[model samples]
Target: MDEALELGEYLPQSFANLNEQTYLDFLWSALRTNYEAERYEFASLAFHLLYMSFVSFSIWQIRLARPGQFAMAMVGFRSEEEGSLLDCESPFKFYDRLKESQIFRFLKLIGCNNEQVGEFAKFVRRRNKIAHPTGTVFFNDQAAIDEEIASMMKEVRNIEAHMQPVIRELYHRFLRDSADPEEREYTVLGDEITANFVHKNYMSAADIAFCQGFDIDALSGEPLHDAMKDLHDALVALYPAEGDVEEAA
Candidate 1:
């Protein structure tokens, strides 16, 4: 007999109240449960190991690439091209800009708060190390590795438990709230926004054209200015101001 059958046989009468079909269902369910747990554990271990390797690799890359200069350029801390050395300084400038960005706002709407987004960005950066590397040697530190893996597994489980319901609800709402045509438009718009912003300059002219093919004015048969005003109002309502900060006097 299979281990599952043997295990089922050993169960007490109360535990075995499941019918034959239910027993089969329980067996399959048990297999799936084990598989998911093992898969998560494996992924967690892999991620933790990758993160450790990333820390080492990132340090090396920084030394070789002189990424400090790149970071400085990105944040306008120093202007090597403009013959200026670290003059402009505003710590919150980048944060403020990110707050205003459409992509960031969308992410915020989908329950990924600023702190969570920062952690996700770090995870992506770590993932890049492995992706960009030609080769890597696996280092064994069993105890530490195991602990890191456990922590990662817990974190992943926590995230899934917390976010899965919210995501499901959002998906259900989208399906219910939108008509077929509106759903198609929303999907196209989402794809376009992702390709335009997330993928940077990777998209071709054809791809750009495909994304921009939808003519909102033509579809709605409304003036462009009126459509824009409506869009602005919707956005403002979606992401309302936090406090009673008065406008500049």
Candidate 2:
């Protein structure tokens, strides 16, 4: 009872409607019937005993690959010579041997500091040690659990921060270049922007011609904060989001 109270003191139990639940929400609801947020338990499990982290990581990688662009995250985010190191089109090809595949390079390419990169590498090794099962006992106390989840999210945020400009550019180009209602057989682009992200059909048909049409380099000078703000403004102008979404993490 005391532990639960202490947890509540910090967590302040949040709730979401059925359709509005985020990934973390669903996780908590499944784990605890009360749906109290026992954060980092999943991260500890993910790194220590479960393969769920890899599945989540794949989703992030796909997001970074930018579905509507010709660019794959592995190659697109790199400098010309560095990208040429591996002549690959998709990151999926190298998922099996991620450690040896220069996964650390992705952090460096996205401009993570040396300290952050080193920390990420340390967590990767920790995950590996647990994965191999060497008759060694692994302790996942609450603090350690929190650290693992924090570390994973920190690196993800680092990449996302750097990507704001390019991503916003893609969104803008998607709205600007797509055909009007007269030619298309679906919802209008502006209205469809209210959906998860632009239109579903728009995401499916990512041709080289369409990719070549928009020059992502145009956003090179934009600051990360400005890019994110611009994207938000653009979205709100096209189709306003609810006030509740702003409260989300």
Candidate 3:
């Protein structure tokens, strides 16, 4: 009981304005939003991680094939204390560490075509916006909310179209080159990788597409489509419609 009372001392003075039930309501809302927000954030992260893994693997292969070339090209990424290397493991951090132009140049060196390099930059930028904190509140107007949803779906499709083929080709090439003919998993490597990644990471269809030989169209497939729709509906319900806000006002 004393510990509980001590915890109360840390509560903000502004919270005193709210009744206890209001506090409970706020807690419940936070709980709901936190789950939904995490799911949404992680959905994007699935794609981001898969993309990073592909790039990292390709970079490793480049190092294996031409040790001097990869190192020489990465000189720009080097800092005063650090040598030319992408220190961060995550795609977003790798992107942040290097200038956009530098990243594009490095991608070219590593075998990404001009179009693939541009698409990758765009995809990473979108992922960064999603990952970073933005103080913008949810739209209280229905039309605005609809617009926001449309924007999200468009971004989703953009990521799908641009990154899927690139990732597919990368993994396909990797497996083709790296897999041993005698290994049992050689023939089913794609399916094995897809299953493991999806099970372990709760990866979205987009994440699995590279290994599964699918595309953004998979997003509209049965299980994924229903799951995505449920998440979307839940998120939409969290925001107040224009009429509801006016009524509250």
Candidate 4:
């Protein structure tokens, strides 16, 4: 938005009477929302939803960005010849069954080591406890709440560490491998990846937590890489740079 305002200054004639102050704070609305947990159970449940959504979104992206080999392999048919008509079933029947699936095996296949896989699994049991009904009583236990949040973040790190590199490598290959004839299909691949992350919401705050599961920094690298330059050119066309943001006097 700030980027648009700055550019709009130079293009005043493009839109009659548009000014920097015209749509100044239109990025978000005036309504404010706040949630406070006075009960331990409520806090636990709230955190559970936040943490789960983050992880789930990440997994969804992985499924979308997967290469052909690993994509169909998650269906448990990667090793067998064609015979079963039920082969079209989704590998993830539901998000709840993620822990029971061959997710760890898939992680290893995608180049993540056992430790990274194990670290991500460390919180599933705890998450399950809060996600389902149990005879356990609830109290305002600060220490336990702290521990759960810490563990959830630990799992977040494992996902970023183990999963992102896989996407990066595949994204790079997509840019280079499909370019024997022209300037390359980097834009095509970039759009495929970006469209996966495209969000239309105009809100802020907790939305950042939802970014954990997807092809975020996967297509990125130090500015030194030629692929990074190509990817930047593709992305900058879509999202204008903040460096261009400046108020016109």
Clashes of each: 0, 0, 0, 1
Sort order, TM-score high to low:
4, 2, 3, 1
User: Against the hidden reference, what TM-scores do the models get?
Assistant: 0.25, 0.48, 0.35, 0.49
Clashing pairs in 4: 58-213
How well does candidate 3 match the true structure in TM-score terms?
0.35
Q: What range of 10 consecutive residues in model 4 has the weakest lDDT sum?
A: 26-35
lDDT of 1 by residue, 106-165 (tens): 233334577764553454444445455547522233443355444444433333333333
Q: Roughly what TM-score does model 2 have, to 2 decimal places?
A: 0.48
Clashing pairs in 2: none
State the RMSD for candidate 3.
17.3
Per-residue CA lDDT of model 3 for 106-197, tens digit only, reads 55654557776675556567666666778643333434434433444443344344444444544333333333434424244434333322
Candidate 2 — which residues are off by over 4 angstroms? 1-43, 47-101, 107-109, 113-116, 183-185, 194-249
lDDT of 3 at 240: 35
Q: Rank by lDDT, highest first.
A: 4, 3, 2, 1
RMSD of each: 20.4, 10.8, 17.3, 12.2
- Cα error, candidate 4, residue 141 (Å): 3.1
Residue ranges of candidate 1 with Cα displaced over 4 Å: 1-107, 131-138, 164-249
Name the lDDT value of residue 128 in candidate 1: 49
Error of 3 at 127 (Å): 12
